[model samples]
Target: MIDKLSWMAIYPEAALLIMACVIALLDLSTTSPRRTATYVLTLLTLAVIAVLTGFNAAAGKTIYGFGGMVVSDPMGNWLKCFATLALMVTLVYGRPYAADRGMLRGGEMFTMSMLALLGMFVMMSGSNFLVLYLGLELLTLSSYALVALRRDNALASEAAMKYFVLGAMASGFLLYGLSMMYGATGSLDINEVFKAIASRQVNHQVLVFGLVFIVAGLAFKVGAAPFHMWVPDVYQGAPTAITLLIGAAPELAAFAIIIRLLVEGLLPLAIDWQQMLTLLAIASLLVGNLAAIAQTNLKRMLAYSTIAQMGFMLLGLVAGVVNGNTYNAQFAYSAAMFYIVTYVLTTLASFGIILLLAREGFESEEITDLAGLNQRSPLYAGVMAIAMFSLAGVPPLVGFYAKFAVLQALIASGQAMHIALAVFAVVMSLIGAFYYLRVVKVMYFDAPLTATTVAAPPDVRAVLTVNGALILILGILPGSLMTLCAQAIVATLAS
Candidate 1:
């Protein structure tokens, strides 16, 4: 049933794949010091994709193509647009840092990142089990190479190996679950599977058995505690630039798949999955925040922070279908989406500051490395301070609102356990604030570790400024983005 519209549905993805190949060839042929040609080409490609995606989203029509294996909808389009923007900013903030560390010796970083982005695009659009799994592999394979790009760093190589082994295991869990699902329902299409399950035409026990594995796989992907062993090590060992690449944008893709699998494909099993998510969220918040309090490395601390933040997102998902009614589905899912989007924005600036502080031979991996950052460069310190405060869910910042939205969704569910969950989340967040504020305190109150002035290229500085400003502006006035999320989710569920 492939048609012209099927191809049209994938225009942005097609353009990116072609451009990535062209850029790879151009990088090999050109003899530029900074690989300026490749950099410009990559950014231009991303900008064009972003524009196309925004246009598609604004059109507000849901199109299913490729025999219903791929979907073009407001939710997918908006996530793709933002993911492309995140990649562009990642490259901009990363270039100087990558160049300083000789990571630009080859163009693999740029090409691989572009490919990983393509994977995200596919994941967002996938409406079939096989398509989703394929997309996940593409992204993880590219990320493995990116993490080990340094080749000479033992720690980097070790992190890559660990990520590879664990990622493969998770993929197997997902695949095995998908097979069981297909056997139970006799379909690979997500919508059809949903129909089968919702109609009570499938064996309930088999479906739930398969769902356990699927949830386990997704839990690993999102780095929930008990499955987050690789996060801290990889964040600490991989180059900061690669860590940012892994952290910032792929989260949108992760959220997309969660919706496609759990909500769209298995809503009939909400009571079952929600129970699992509840346990995962509680464990993640408990382990992530408490363990982070002991870390000295900023990256590792942020790694734990990412886990806790993801837990908060899960809270939204768990509250979506209380008492077998989905009247609140859009609100709950939209809150989770908004939280992920804003978290990525703050993360970009947080890691951008770390990347900026690293000089020719100095890596700012330790928290003490930021001691008295205000004395060295008030502007950079201020940006970092804003990011830290925002992540801590402090007042008048986006993080607080993100948490508040999720907690509100949880409390509104009217389940006693959910109300308890909301209270627990607040307490865990209060504990987590200690580490985030510690970073800020060191920046403003401690003595400088070195007298060297913080410096960054104009482009990096410009991006960081915009990133920080957006965090504050969105915090103060979050209506537009929140509305957008609500619209996107409503449109998705309707389709």
Candidate 2:
């Protein structure tokens, strides 16, 4: 009966895929300009799906589809919500820019966007290596095309090529790692791999090597340092809309990959990956923060900042594994999830502002581009200031609390290095503050780049209203979201 209750739970994910295909078909068949209609319909579809997912969660049923490959746990539910919200914000932000640039291409853009969302769905629900890989590929492929949508822009073309080449190499490493793991355990199922590893006590060095490769592959996807050479370039070169999409989902998906494999499949080999993550985290912090300071381009700066954030998330994973307490691990995981949510909102909001200033054939990449913005639109300047403060982990902002919670988890577990890294993270964040504030300084102090304020499309305005309010709202009352995060981690990693 549980299996047969219509299984409408997965409709949220299916809606995205179905919408993508349908939009593509309609575009090819009819040359009518129903672009706004497509946008409205797409947003509506996602809204309905979000409502359904919420309803399913409230009903308290564990819904799985495709023979246990896609589990409907709280982790899936939460990430799905994050992915959808982020995409919605991007659509609202991008619609005007796309229209102005004459690049919306109506159906094509909508299709790729939804396809990327579907890829995110795969990441959220994937319970096996095969499903995870498939999902990741779908997201990567869609991202590549979206980046190159302009076709004529040299930078966009270059970004797509680099992304494709690097993405292929990462896939190769991941596939090789999966093959090695299969060789060691004679199984591809995560549950079976865990049981086998737990039951046997042998030095399976081959499997360990596979773990290294697998983690390397995942780090590449997350754009973590030492595996992050491609990040700034891609983020800088991709269309701003595509950059927004890439930033939102891939890191969350990478985190899921780590949770499923490192936390479950290789638990007995804890010391190994924990040490690896610590070193990786430190490298990411140093490289990401140090490199970001020199970037003149806003998108590239944010891309490096993303790398820095990934490093912080790994701090939580290392804390969880090394401390050897289930509750501590849960706290660490919950902290990481909270941070991800915080970062996603902040990142989307930041990008949305960038879109506001951006127009066709006039992409605003330089920090100088925003000179004298505060006087032009005090509201935008204020909202952007809060976003910057929050991103820098300043006090009374949600970003600060996210970092604080993780730091507390690390110190409470008595991990000396974790505490040290948090200190370093704070320092790098201080270094990062210089740039985030530069945007603020330009807005507040410098003369206006444009004497007249630009007006945005209504959709963009509506989206900003929610996005701006959310950052402060979260900072003020994070308890509810924090509780939900804690519960989600519990549902995902059953002890």
Best by lDDT: 1
The lDDT of each candidate is 0.93, 0.80
lDDT of 2 by residue, 206-233 (tens): 8789989988888888888899988999
TM-score of each: 0.99, 0.95
Query: Compared to the true structure, candidate 1 yields what TM-score?
Result: 0.99
Compared with the true structure, what per-residue lDDT tens digits does model 1 show for residues 1-495?
568989988888999999999999989986776789889989998999999999999999899889999999999999999999999999999898888888888899999999999999999999999999988999999999999998888988998999999999999999999999999999999999999999997889999999999999999899997888888998898999999999999999999999999998999999999999999999999999999999999999999999999999999999999889998899899999999999999999999999999887888989999999999999999999999999999979999899999998998888999999999999999999999999999999999979999878889999999999999999999999999999999998997
Query: What's model 1's overall lDDT?
Result: 0.93
How does candidate 2 fare on TM-score?
A: 0.95
The candidate maximizing TM-score is 1
Query: Where is the poorest 10-residue window by lDDT in model 2?
Result: 1-10
Q: Which parts of model 2 are misplaced by more than 4 Å?
A: 1-9, 29-34, 201-203
User: Once all C-alphas are superposed, what RMSD does model 2 give against the true structure?
Assistant: 2.0
